[model samples]
Target: MSRLTERLHRMLHADDRLDREMAAEWEEAPAGKPASLPPEEVNPDTPAEQPDWWISVPFRQGRGLRRLLVVLSVLLCVGIITVLVITAQYLPHFGQAGNPANNEVSRRYIENGMEETGAVNIVAGMILDYRAFDTLGESNVLFTAVCAVMLLLRVSADKRRSAAYQLELETDDRMYEPKNDLILRSIARLLIPCILLLGMYIILNGHLSPGGGFSGGAVMGAGLILMLNAYGFRRMERFFTIRLFRAVTVCALSFYALSKAYSFFTGANHLPSVITPGTPGMIFSAGLIPYLNISVGLVVCCTIYSLYTLFRKGDL
Candidate 1:
């Protein structure tokens, strides 16, 4: 029994000594080297660490191209500035008394414009009658700019959040809400009708008064903006929808184009026109000028409103 007990003690001491030697060896191993794990524990499918994106081949190429483009753009701008400076230095001074603008063309327009266009406002006569083609080009430019903006910024309905969801989100966002001040609402309510009436008076009397289509249209647009600010977009949308905007804009442009075309054809051929230029200084005097003013007003009003709506919420 004593010999059996002694053998058991010897076995226990041998196991302890083996464990101590293994732990010492593990502690002494360099951290730079991985521990010698069992073959079955190794993972062969694990991926290696990748370098940063900035050091990749495609990224380096793109960076080089971007730098080249920036340099080229700078050079182009400098060249254009130099050319414009040289050209301007050789040109006539501002508002010179003897400039060609003070010539016979101006005299004829100033003296006979009322008789020719029946518009007491000479500036209105000049823009809508004498240089109607230029006004047409300007309107077309505005339309083109609007289309370009829509193309770039308008998102597809499929990609966008549902209208109901979007509306709820926007309603929660207090930034879009109208002020609830009683004084402001009262003032707006009182002034909005007067503003709209005044705008209409300006537009209708454009041929006789100092105000023309552009100015009257601007005032009308301001009135609309005021209404939106006071009452909010949902209320504004009740009367002015995207469909109404499209229809008005298209019809106004078409009418202006066809009317101007007929006028231009008759004048160029020196043919007597059936339409008579009414009595000067009268509200309904200008032959086609009043109609032109209405058309221009419609175009301008729609443009202003559309721009506001589109920029605010990326839609109209």
Candidate 2:
């Protein structure tokens, strides 16, 4: 019995020693940071040392691109600046001293449309009949911008959290939610509808007056933004689905393109339209011109609203 006990004791002691040696080895291993470091020692790895001059130098070198580009850019800028300066200098003389392009376009739209299409508004005539293609291009641009903005929005919180743990990334700030204010919200609610209605009116009247589709659409979009701030994202989502906006955009662009192609192919470009560009000064009618302006206004308003929603909400 005594001999058996002695053997057992030796086995236990050996196991204990092995455990202790392993623990010591682990503690002494050359790994991560020590408990302390000398204050005088500096960390060599820092963002400040990694100079970004390589990236910056490329931009500097780009300044010496083909002379043609420089000349063209300068000429373009000068032309625009010259127009703005001259406009600022003599806007009062706009009607008295007319530009050939402006006069020709205006005269063709107002005079010819009434004579041919019987449209009352010159601006409407220009957009709907003469420049539908341009409106379509502009609408596509807005749609593209909306998509890009949405794509850049931050990922979901769960995704962000997963990334932080897996890749050691810091948390990104979430979009802000405004504090509740009953009074402000009420005011917004009251004002938003009026603003939207006004925009619609502007769009509708574009053929008859100074305002056009772009202006009207932009105004309505602003109203939508205001409503989002005042009410909430959910409400906006419920009311204005992206699908609806996409449908409207596609339809408008399609109609514009197809109509323009038809007009061009059929050589109806100068042919008289069904609608009379009513007497030059009348507010009652403009031919297809007013309709085109309304379409553009709708497209612009939808685009602006869609963009605002994408940035603010981040979810598709």
Candidate 3:
């Protein structure tokens, strides 16, 4: 009876060991190799072939689906081009004098724009006086974009290293220094003032000349970028700090919004305006256009500088 019990116990232990081995084999089977089969199930005379991995993955199995996708993409592009071409044919021809755009409204604006807005530059008058609201919307858009970028990219003070460390980092002249390039430095020195002067001229004379706030601001931004590249951040920060940037941008945008709101209200109501459109060709002729240009320039300048500074060092 004791010998019979021992045999039964040995059988149970063998079964358990086999079960554990099977479990381990199953766990490893999906990892590119097949589990070992029992000796009784294996047939040595006929070798078992491994199944192709690609058979389970539909994308790798055939080129037909990829070709179909490519063909459909090409067809979609062709259809879009065909639609655009057909639409273009129905559109009015370019530079046609009798086009709907050359209407009485345009004529009135052209004829009386200078007298009404006191701006010699008809384009300036049209943008700032006639379509002042549109320009305001554009300025708001710029401000919003700057705000968004700042929220996304500007690094907080807590995230930055200590001021002493930052000063040490800046003192690494080899990082972005334009060193030993005397010619380049000399040229930059010569051109920076001229660029700044040209930008100011464009902004101030926007009401009397071809350029305006946008163009002049772009030029000024370019000058600032040039100065940064040539002289480095340390020198530029002496005058154009983060505080100055905030102050200038806030003031400029506030003034623009308030003044434009007043102008829009008075013009829409056909009320008498206190602002007198000065002489047509003088420097200060346009009642609010020059001031508006300066405001826009300030906002634009701050935005450009801030963007560059933030992108370079993740702070300003």
Model 3 residue 260 CA deviation (Å) reads 1.6
Off by over 4 Å in 3: 1-103, 162-181
**Model 3 alpha-carbon miss at residue 170, Å:** 10
Lowest summed lDDT over 10 consecutive residues: which window, candidate 1?
Answer: 47-56
* Candidate 3 lDDT over residue span 1-316, tens digit each: 9966775564435445555777788897887677885454334453321121212233332345667998999999999999999999988988899888877988888899999899999999988888877887787788787788888777666435445445546676546655546787788999999999999999999999898888898889889988887777788889998788888888988898899888878878999888779899999788899999888887887788788877777667
Worst 10 residues of 2 by lDDT: 49-58
- Model 2, span 1-316: residue lDDT tens: 9976875565435435544655676677667634332232234565342232222222333333645687999999999999999889864545555554455766666557655554455555665666667667777788788777766773455544443333333233433345456987989978998999999988877766778788899999999889877777777778688678778877876766666676655555677544555565555555456566666787898888877766655553
lDDT of each: 0.76, 0.66, 0.79
lDDT over C-alpha atoms for residue 192 of model 2: 91
In candidate 1, which residue pairs get closer than 3 Å at backbone N, Cα or C atoms, i.e. clash?
none
Between candidates 2 and 3, the one scoring higher on TM-score is 3
Give one digit per residue, the lDDT tens place, for model 1 in 1-316: 9976775564435435444555676677786664552233234353221211112222333444767998999999999999999998987777999876678998899999999899999988999999988887877777777677777666446435454435544566556465766777889999989988888888899899888767777788888888877887788889898788778888988999999899888989999886578999988788999998988887787777777777766667
For residue 42, what is the lDDT in candidate 2?
34
Question: Which ranges in model 2 have alpha carbons more than 4 Å from their true place?
Answer: 1-114, 154-176, 265-284
Pairs with backbone N, CA or C atoms under 3 Å apart (clashes), candidate 3:
none
